[model samples]
Target: MANKTAPLTDTEIRQAKAKEKEYNLGDGKGLLLRIKPNGSKLWLFNYQRPYTKKRAVLSVGSYPEVSLKQARQTRLKYRELLANDVDPKDYKQEQEAQAKEALTNTFEHVANLWLESKRDTITSGHFQQVKRSLEKDLFPSLGKKPISTLKATSFITLLRSIEAKGSLETVKRLSQRINNIMNYAVNYGLIEVNPAQAIGEVFKKPKKKHYPTLKPEQLPDLMKALNTASIQLQTRCLIEWQLHTITRPSEASGTKWSEIDFKQKTWTIPAERMKSRIEHIIPLSEQALALLDIMKSINGNRQHVFSSRINPKKPMNSATANVALKRMGFRGVLVSHGLRALASTTLNEQGFNSDVIEACLAHIDKNEVRKAYNRSTYLEQRIKVMTWWSEHIESTSQNHLLTTKKSRLKVVT
Candidate 1:
C-alpha cells in the first residue's frame, strides 16, 4: 500500500531552507509549495481534468501569502469542482476573464451607448434633458459599477436623494430611463436580465395637473386685455398668431415663414418641431392670415415668423407669450397654453363635432384607425370649424372694443 502523504505544518515550512535545486514539498490532496533555489515560494494545486483525465495545475499564490490553511481551503474548493465534473483550472480561467470583461463594460460606458442611439430619434432639447438627468443623478454614484451586476438597490439611494427634494416626477422619469438603458443592454445580449424594472414603484407618484385655463365667459376679458396690455407689438402678434392657429407655444414660436402657404391658406408644421413628432397642417383663417401679413412686414426677411428681439435670426423665446400673459395682470388666471382649452370649451358649447375640433388642435387619438380616418376626413370640416372659430374670435374682439368706452387700438405696430 502507498504511504499516505502527511499534512504540512507552519513549523515545518518555517524551518525548511532553500536548496541547491528548485523543489516542491507536497501537502495532502495535490497542494504543493515550491521553495525555489532563489528562496521564492509558490503554492499550486495539481488536478486531473474532468472527462479527459488530463493532468492540470492551478497556481493559488506564493507561500506565506497563501498560508497552509488557505492552501487547504483552495484544495477543497478544487475538489468540489472535480466532483461536479468541472475542471477547476478551466473554471478559474473563465471566471478571471469574466471579471476583466465586467470592469470594461461599466454602467457609464453602456449608458453612453444608449444615449447615442437616442441622438437622432428624439428632439435636441429632449435629448439634452435626458443626458443631463443621467449625468446629474445616476453617473456620479453608479457609473463605475459593472452593468451586468446592477440592481434596483443600486438606484435606491440615488432616487431617494432626488425624492427628498420632492421631485417624484423626476424619480419616476429616471427610473424609466434606467429601465430603458437596461432593456437596451438586454436586447443587445449584453445582459441576461434587467434588475431595474420595478425601482419606480417604491416612490410616490406625482399628481397630474392640467393646464390652467379661462372659462368660456372669460374670453371677452382676455381679448380686451390682450389689446391693451403693455406688451410689445411682436409679442401681441405672436400671441394672436398662436391663438388664431390654435398651436402650442414652441410650435408657434418656432414657426418659419417658409412653412406658410398663402395660396393653400395652410401653415405646415414639420414632424420634428411638433410635440407628437408628426407633421401638422393648420388651416389659416382670415385673422391668422392677416396676422402673418403684419409679421411679414416686420420679419418677412428673417427665418422665424416671430424673431427674437435680441437675435432676429432665431425664433421667439417660447416663454415670451407666458411672460406677456403674466404682465397683463392675467397671472395665475390663464397661460398661453390655456388659450387652446378656452377655444375647446367655447366650441364644445357651440355643439360642433368634438372629433373635428380635436383634429384641428392636433391632439392624437389613441385609436390608430380613428386617428388615420380623422386625419384624412376632417380637413374639410376642419376648415369650416376654423373659419367659424376665427369669426367667433373676431366678433368677440369687436365686442371688446364696443364694451370699452374708449377704443384702445391694441395693434402692436
Candidate 2:
C-alpha cells in the first residue's frame, strides 16, 4: 500500500522554523516546501516522466511569493498534465516558447516586414507616404498588439476614430492599407482571416473633388501669364515640360536624366515609378526636346532632370509646380494637374482617336488580353498627336501675344 501524506496549512507552514540543514514539509502529491538553513523556503514539484517513468523536479517559485495553497494547486496542474501523458517540464518549455513568439509577432513587426518586402516594388516616395501614415495614424493604437489577436471590431473602432476627425479620405486609404496588411498576414499563415476585409463597407464614401482646370480657350491666357511670370528658368521649363508632355506633376518632378533617350526621342518611366505599375513611354516632341536641351545645359550633370535647388541630389518637391501656380495668382482657377485635363479635353474635342489619346495619357487598358497583345498599339499616332498638340500651344501663345500687341497699339493711337 502507498504511504499517505497530510496536506500543509498556511499557519503550520509559517510556524515551522528552519533547521541547521535543508528539510522539506510535504503538501501531498509530490509538492514540498524546502526550508533551508539560511531561513529561506522554496516550492518544488517532483514528478515522473509519463513514458520513461524517470524522476524529475520542477521549481514552483520561492515561498512567501508562492503560498502553500498556490504550490498545491500548481502540483495538481502538473499532475493533470501527467495524467494526459505529458511531461510537465516539456509542457512548461513549450509554453515559454509560445510566449516569446507572441511577443515577436506584434502587428508593427509584421507590418514592417510587409513594407520591406515591397521596397523594391514601390517608389521611395510612395513607401515614405505609407510609413508616415502608419507612424502617425495607425501604429499608436494597434502596433504592439499581436496580429492574430486583432479582430474586425478592433479596426472598426480605429477607423471610426479617424472618421470622427473628419478625415473620410484618410479613413478610406487607411482601411485599404489595413486590409492589405491583413491579407498579407493571412497569406503568411499569421492569422486565419482578414479582419479588415469588410471594414471598408462601414465608412461613408467621400465626395469626389476634381482638380480645378482651365477651359481650352483659357490656355492662351495661361500660356501668356506663364511667359510673363517672373519665375526661375528651371521652374518655367518644368511647367512647360509638364504641359507639353501632359504628365502628372509628380512624374514631371521626379523625372531623372537617365529616363530620357536623346536617340529614341522618348522618355520611359519605369514600372515601379508609374501609378499603373506598367512602363510608360512618352514621345518627345520638338518642343519637348528643345526644352530638354536647355535643361541639360543647366542641370545635365545631375541625376534628376528637375533636381531641388536646396538638395540637388534629390528630385524637386512634388508640390513645387502647384505652389508656383498659386503664387502666380492662379490658385483657385488652375492647378498643375489641370494641364492633363486641358490636354484631354482639347484632344477629344479635336476628334483624336480615343485609344491614341488614352495611350498618350498612360491610362491602363481594362482588358488584360488586349493590353498584353497591344502594349503600344497607338505608338505612331501618339507621337503624331503629341507633336500636333505642342505646335497648337505654340501657335495659340503667339497669336495671343500678337492680339495683345495690336490692342496696345490701338490704345496708343
Question: What are the TM-scores, per candidate, against the unseen true structure?
Answer: 0.84, 0.85
Per-residue lDDT tens digits of candidate 1, residues 333-375? 8899988998888888888889998998899999999999999
Candidate 1 lDDT trough over 10 residues, lowest sum: 404-413
Error of 2 at 190 (Å): 4.0
- Global lDDT for candidate 1? 0.85
- Please give the distance, in angstroms, between residue 80's alpha carbon in candidate 1 and its true position after superposition: 3.6
- Residue 155 local lDDT, model 2: 87
Task: Report lDDT (Cα) of residue 412, candidate 2.
Answer: 7
Backbone atom clashes (below 3 Å) for every candidate: 0, 0
- Those runs of model 1 whose alpha carbons end farther than 4 Å from true positions after fitting are 1-4, 13-22, 36-40, 50-54, 63-65, 83-85, 398-413
